[model samples]
Target: MTSLSTSKLLALLALFVWQAHASLANSPRSLPARDEFVCPAEDIANTGCLGPKDCLYANPNNCNTFIRCIANADGTGTPVVLPCLLELEWNDNKKECDFPENSTCPPK
Candidate 1:
């Protein structure tokens, strides 16, 4: 009975820790607004894309963030920084967020 009670206590502790970590990660104070994130100058200068479709690029500096270039009628684009869901990374080949193991992210 004592062992069972101890196990339950440990489980509750783990649950509390996980909840706290998740809440911190999702807190507005921890992340910037989508519009507020500024793309690095290198990313802006390197985009060769032009036209109707938005372009997606992996963020070289941050595995959790990606860049999206919104196409304009004038053949220019505005770069926006975006974050992947927790524990995921940008997958350049598949053009979406994916698990880090399956992504093309360079080794840190």
Candidate 2:
């Protein structure tokens, strides 16, 4: 190929690489801020009850008001905000907090 054509091709390739790099750099590393929802205590317990689950209850007197956020499996940028609950269930194959209906867990 001609020198001019080769230089133009190289410049185009460089521009493409730079744009790709920039896009990747700006891409979010974690879940986006809008798609998440808080899971409710009842759902987390998997007891099929809407009322508070006994296993997940927190002491009102000693409970703190901090909130925990979690991301969903979808690529959409959304996270669920959960109240810091007392008892947490650990499902070996599931995420840290997996409430069937609600995404955010109730505060402990």
lDDT, residue 26, model 1: 44
- Ten residues in sequence with the least summed lDDT for candidate 1: 25-34
In order of appearance, the predictions have TM-scores of: 0.50, 0.29
4-87: candidate 2 lDDT, tens digit per residue: 999999999999977864564344343233333343543434433323221232212222211222223332212222332233
lDDT of 1 by residue, 1-108 (tens): 699999999999999977875564344322234455444444335554442223676766678877776545555555566677667898888877799898889877
In model 1, the Cα lDDT at residue 79 comes to 59
> Model 2: how large is the Cα RMSD against the reference?
17.9
Candidate 1 displacement at residue 89 in angstroms = 0.5
The CA lDDT of each predicted structure is 0.65, 0.37
> What is the model-wide C-alpha lDDT for candidate 2?
0.37
The best candidate by lDDT is 1
Please report how far candidate 1 places residue 25 from its true position, in Å.
Answer: 16
